[model samples]
Target: VGRDKLLRTLQYFSRFYAWYLFRTNRPQTAIAPFESIKKQFGLTRKILRIGKFIEHFKAAAVAFDNKAPVDPILRCLAVGRQLGYAGYMSYDTITVIHALGIKKLANPKKMQENAYRAWLASLVCSAIAGVYSLWKLHQREKLVDRTEGEGAVELKKIQKYVFSMQERAAARVQLISDLFDLPIPLSGVGIVPLDDGIVGLSGTVSSLLGIWSAWKKTA
Candidate 1:
């Protein structure tokens, strides 16, 4: 529980720092997109009447003017997300280590009880983090969609910022996915999956070692 709390604290700090930078370093005066397709083409009516596609691209070309890019925010987000994942990995590794130590206890039940509590606490914290990640991703997606819908003029002004957030979000999501789905390459012919399966296997091996230690004590 202590270790997980420490990791969680680190993750929160990373996010706080990112948000601080994002707010303080925000770019100046930006224009929103101009939605004209509904007014000129009346997309639904045109499609219903002619059963054909409307030339919205031409309309967009005529309306858009801004071409400048917005300040980038990906680096801030990338740093935070990577730190957060590092915390998670550390937490998981410690949890497995604790599980492996279970067999070394003379009174295994007491240690098991504490381990279960720690596991439960970590699980709850992990669930909260996962929810927050999902929520943040959803918010970023909305930002991307809003910017894109506004057309190129508005998009051009803030496209880079939105894309940066998107790229970071994609990378974070990929990292989380890869944690469970990908394999770790340590050296030649030393590839192994870095998922819960490995954690379980490692914990079991540790427990067996602990048993051996206890048997030696008895002997």
Candidate 2:
């Protein structure tokens, strides 16, 4: 009789224990099955957030808008924090970081446009120098009494093509400047022939100067 009572008592507790464990697992059960999904979404949102942080990089890659870049940067930071500290800096999180770094050059509001303008202008000047040098070479060839025949004409034609390329290349620099709101004029740019027959180039020095000003202010 005592043994039977003891058995009933133990059985009763076991039933109660099982019920407790089951009832308490309501929230826990849902978690194990959905963890992967939660992480995937969390990470995707994080990546997109980072994209906004580096809007300038996007502008550089794509000539989208040049308005305020700060808005996007803030968005990225907010999303990143929501993703939690641990997940915010994961492997793919690096995508946002790299994009941000690469796009840093596109911030025209910080006078970045001037900087690009300067670089493009310098390129234009260098190209002009190259073409003038080649033309001078061609002219010297024609003046030479040695083999001033078919070779000279062919050289002149090749040099003309080269000049065309330089002209086109220089024109692109202006386009780059225009994108940044600093207009550049192709006029007043000239190349002088040096004593050693080498070519020297000079143009508006202000493009680079303006670029320097932008940098100093940015700093």
Candidate 3:
């Protein structure tokens, strides 16, 4: 709960910062958790796969824009699942759709373009973050890590591995959030798969507009 609160605070503040800095309609709520979650998972493997998914989706969106439509449904599903694997990856298409915006970004598309490297680095960083988080947790509760030589070494190694390259990931969460606009903190959303590979997002995001608005926009 404390962690979640801290993340939310960061996200809210980051959005303020992004708006102050970027002036785009995008939000950063979904970015930090998404990247963190992706790192938590196979940071290297899954991210690369998701990056490919984004690339394919971008190509398809362009083709569709040109009246040569290919299905973005599968790509949406893949993104959805990938987001889901991330701890805070929500199932709501409203917030989830923000992810698409980031994936399609051209200028700062490092996460998508260099999918493999970003993924690997993220995983490395996440592992580091995890260790420190654990250490903090252990400090709060002595049973978490003993203070013996081997224990100290284990703790030290985890700290070194994480902090050493952490600078690289400094903007990780913000980058992803800005990239995808996935951090809207929408209230209600759910998915229901229908026949013929069609899926529906059901719920509300903001104002009185729930999934209905999302449907209208997508429709």
Q: Judging by TM-score against the true structure, name the best candidate.
A: 1
lDDT of 1 by residue, 1-219 (tens): 233223323333333343444456643221111112212222222223231112222322322432445222432333333433333343334334444463343554444334334333333333344445566666766666575645566656476667656555544543343332222211111333243234333333433433444454467
Per-residue CA lDDT of model 2 for 69-120, tens digit only, reads 5345334433332232223223234443444464433332324223233334
lDDT of 3: 0.34
Better TM-score candidate (2, 3): 2
For each candidate, the alpha-carbon lDDT, in order, equals 0.37, 0.37, 0.34
The regions of model 1 sitting more than 4 angstroms off are 1-106, 147-219
Model 2 residue pairs with clashes: 57-103
Quality of model 1 by C-alpha lDDT: 0.37
Q: Worst ten-residue run, lDDT, model 2? A: 195-204
Q: What lDDT does candidate 3 reach at residue 6?
A: 35
> Which tens-of-lDDT digit does each residue in 1-219 have in candidate 3?
233323333433433443343334445664445335323432332233333444444543544455434335434433433333232321122222335453333333333333323323333333344444445444534532344356558887566545634533433432332222221212111122221111101101111132223344467
Comparing 1 and 3 by TM-score, which wins? Answer: 1
C-alpha lDDT of residue 52 in model 2: 45
Q: Tell me the number of clashing residue pairs for each predicted model.
A: 0, 1, 8
Please give each candidate's TM-score.
0.27, 0.21, 0.18
Clashing pairs in 3: 29-183, 30-183, 31-177, 102-179, 102-180, 128-162, 203-211, 204-210
Candidate 1 weakest ten by summed lDDT:
30-39
